[model samples]
Target: MLSGGSTGVGLTARDELESTISLARTADKRGFHRFWMSEHHGMGAASVSSPPLMIARLIAETTRVRLGAGGMMLPNHSPLLIAEQFGMLEALAPGRIDLGLGRAPGTDGATAAALRRGADANDGFPQQVLELLGFLDDDFPSGHPYRQVHAVPGPWQAAENRVSTPTGTPQTWMLGSSPYSAQLAGQLGRPYAFALQFGDADVDTAMRLYRENFQPSDALAKPHTLVSVSVAISEDPAEARRQAGTSAMAMLRMFKREGYLLLPPDEVQAYQPTMQERHILDAYTDRSFHGTPETVADRLEDLHARTGADEVMLVVGGHCASLDREGISLIADHYAMPRSEIPLPVAAQ
Candidate 1:
């Protein structure tokens, strides 16, 4: 099934945030299975600093698309608090909520330090995942320090002990671009999402490790996996590449520690790249899928065949809101995704 991933990139935070809502609505109408927003702090290129808040907003705007964080960086906050926030979200949307957890800081060192306040929480990601799961399930072992703690509005609060319809916990997913997270997700039997959009080179190895270590758990019966890929699709291949170049430029800036900014396509086309910068951009472009809908769809199909991923999450790329939405629509059309008959709800005045 097709899904979407957004980082809310635009010229301004307000515009980017609003664009995300619009994109989510479009994704829902186009029959995309899920729509996930990413969390990034102190990045000018990305407006979403809190995926939970964005997810909640998207939930209000869309009718049936699964809403979630592409992920919430676990080390940046307390497990109990996350459990509580997501629990409330699950209560609000029932089976439509997803909580994809990740181990990275989701920002630069300085910003990460500010967020963590000198805590070395990244090293304890596995423990935190367990703690968060415990809170969500309200099933911590006896004598555990947090045994008495409960995430209110959690799965334990389902009416009549029901696990369907109006009562259910958020579907939990493990998001990562590395082997550590892959193995952990497998060991815990959670659905794993590999962030291939970021140009991670170890996708094959990571996927292998995850399946090898997978263990059945209450949350999952088999090794479920999704690979998030960067995509730029258009009727014209050249136009698609032009749009994708902007993202490559942003990646180059980020690698240089110059901060991330998605320059407009015209500006990106005019800029000159040094040999090293050119290498970075070329590598990113090579790994990303950008072309006409036919080409991108074929690449995605090949990816699934190679990795055996259960789903392919597209991180549609472009320098503007319209192009991003267009890319999503084009892919859906190419795949013959069923269109939703439900119209988007009108916003309040």
Candidate 2:
């Protein structure tokens, strides 16, 4: 499951870290496949600006769960720097680090421009990804200009390439909400992950295009596809709708150009949307699953059947940490995830 490091009412930065750590521990104990953190800048809803920084902390705290960036925006930073950072992570964690790359800015235009230092935003997403992989693999072609440059502490060890190190390489993933990224990932033979959580995407169509166009590269032997979704499960129908309301309000505000600020549940309960908003919320409800464990699980099953997803990454949320944790716990239980050694008590209690 992917944790966006959600920040809710009265949640402090310290609390955000603690909650994420707690969630990671629980996921690790439950044997969840991975625990990825999102990267966002200048956003109130999410607190983590540097996923790699948090991942470094998480690696020391959790023993089993694969920790990674839900994505690091490729347009916002240098590919060589990312290779060094993730390479370091692989060195520390061995087989447990994943580097999910995205083309979006992950922030407001102003902030994105600031992060990129006025560089061209749409210039070269696919090229940057290839550069990053080349750095990670230390395999630049002979004619490439930057071929001599190497990411230190990288996959390659020794001065003259005569020796090797046991430091594992991070698995590279391409994450997107659009067909462009899907097609690129397939053509490059990288694992493709689609963000269905807050995307206006045709997940099945995207996946099909990816699989049909896939070409094996050094990173992958065949097409690998994963879907990310947000789930909200509640036994009480009212509560489930309430949870969906928060997300709706956030989207409503965004649609109106107000921004992605999340309103409190009480405020959302009192909100009345326009005809346009009503349509948007209905579409959102159909895209995501919100109900009891059984109901949500069935929806996820159908989603998988439709998308032919090799894996589904749950990007969950709720009004608060407790509720969010409980929602994730419910889904985990339905999937028969073993109880964490350090059970999720804040939610359970």
List the global CA lDDT of all models: 0.84, 0.80
How far residue 227's Cα lies from its native spot in candidate 2, in Å, is: 0.4
* Per-structure clash totals for the candidates: 0, 0
Highest lDDT scorer: 1
* Top candidate by TM-score: 1
For model 1 the local lDDT of residue 341 reads 64
lDDT of 2 by residue, 1-349 (tens): 6555766655677887778877777678777888998889876667789999999988877777889998999888899999999988988888999999998888778888888886577678878988998898888999998788988767566445655554567999999888788888899999999998875778877887898889999879989888888766777766876777677667666667676665678887777778888888677655667888888888889988988888888776555666667777788888888875753335333
| Whole-structure CA lDDT of model 2 | 0.80
After superposition of all CA atoms, the RMSD between model 2 and the true structure is 3.3
Off by over 4 Å in 2: 158-165, 340-349
For each candidate in turn, the TM-score is 0.94, 0.92
Candidate 1: tens digits of C-alpha lDDT, residues 23-133:
888888889888887778987778788998888788779889899987899999999999999988987787898889998888999999999987576888899999999
